[model samples]
Target: MAGPRAFAAAASLSMLFALSPATAQTPPTESIQIGLSTDAISITAGFSGADLTIFGSLENPDPLIARQGRYDVVVVLEGPPRPVVVRRKDRVLGVWINLDSEAFENVPVSYSVATTRPLQDIAEPAKYKQLSLGAQNLYMKPVDETDSPATIEEFTAALRERKTATGLYSENVGGVQFLSQNLFRATVRLAPNVPVGTHKARAFLFKSGMFVKESSAQLEIRKSGFEQSIFRVAHDYSFLYGVFAVSLAMLTGWLGRLIFRKD
Candidate 1:
């Protein structure tokens, strides 16, 4: 009877241990994915601006962490890279003239950011600098690297200011929202003067203010309607387009003189 009682006590202890929790097995690693409903977007002649919606999913998201609202997402839409020349105007004899110029290569024509929360609240500034995640943190390579750091910094700031003023560089806080535990949506603004080219859409996942995963997709922005035809002609037939433009200008001048001239 004593041996049987001891055996029963041991069995009960083992069962309690098993029921306590399963903490040994590692949780699955989380990842992020994004998709575009269409690979291309067409803008008509009257396009002022619009919102582009991006859908994404969080894979292997921890239910507890998600419930606690630790998951965050940041989405970026970056336009095609192009060389830009930023010039500074100095007042010379009361005339503002271009004085100092800085040329930057491979600069994104447009940059738009959308985030679940403010960037500062989501991650540290150092983390964002490491990831090059924001317009302010983006590195702009100057053509002349031999210049002084102060000059480069000044020009870089100027360039960013110009881009922001034109609505080419923007940040939209709270633009990303989690529809469910693992699904999310982001809306990014397309400026009226958004460039037409291949744009990259990227999504970054953060857990508890730490960067977790990243995903990206490509999107083509093209012109449509009569504007598209003109754009194609200007590029595909540059010589003929130039001739036609000059002839049209001359013809317009002649017509205006004939209609409104006083002799």
Candidate 2:
């Protein structure tokens, strides 16, 4: 079976082929490309998240600096979103019990961002919020609109705290750096809790504190090898999988007793 790196290579080629035609005909998009190092990533068994480097460059005919004050780049990676249930536990008579619960919908399973400079220095708060440049300003909506606003906000904060604690969501100011003005790279980490799906990789270019152009790519993360087969079987035939698991445990116990038998 192919390893994670092998999957990464295949994903890279897939992205290249998907974007080749567009890049060839475009009149120069926001001036950035994500295939700098590898556009996609794969998570295999024993995966504990890894530092993925995003390589990009400015595509301009003019001198590296076009009579501008400076250029800033911000790169962000976002995983697929799914409904998340956050429950608040309370102590009741020497035991912890579920008190209140909130169901959130379409929350990012994983998110990370790196910027050339502090987000405040790059753009105004209003601007950044509009562009979704900062993690704190991400769009999160409640699935059940019947819930009260206060309750919804509380659950949202709780959800953010949980994801943050597990390194699923992050905000790294000044993460992007210029290698030589035109060429630059940003290092972002993928969390072990990242869900398997097609994650998005986006890069935004700012010229003298104003948003100029942007580009985006896709990253595919999936399970491989034994893990893949096991996951497939479990989800496809849950009842059978459970029975097999139980049977295997019993057989193992029987064999252990037989092997260690003594007079």
Q: What TM-score do all the candidates reach, one by one?
A: 0.85, 0.79
Candidate 1 regions exceeding 4 Å error are: 1-24, 246-263
Query: Per-residue alpha-carbon lDDT of model 1 for 51-95, expressed as tens digits?
Result: 788888887777889999999999999999999999999999999
Which residue pairs clash within candidate 1? none
Regions of candidate 2 where Cα sits further than 4 Å from its true position: 1-30, 36-40, 61-69, 261-263
In order, the Cα lDDT scores of the candidates are 0.85, 0.74
Best by lDDT: 1
Residues 26-110, model 2: lDDT tens digits: 6344466655345445567777667667777776513434435378888998889888899999899989999899887787789
lDDT of 2 at 263: 50
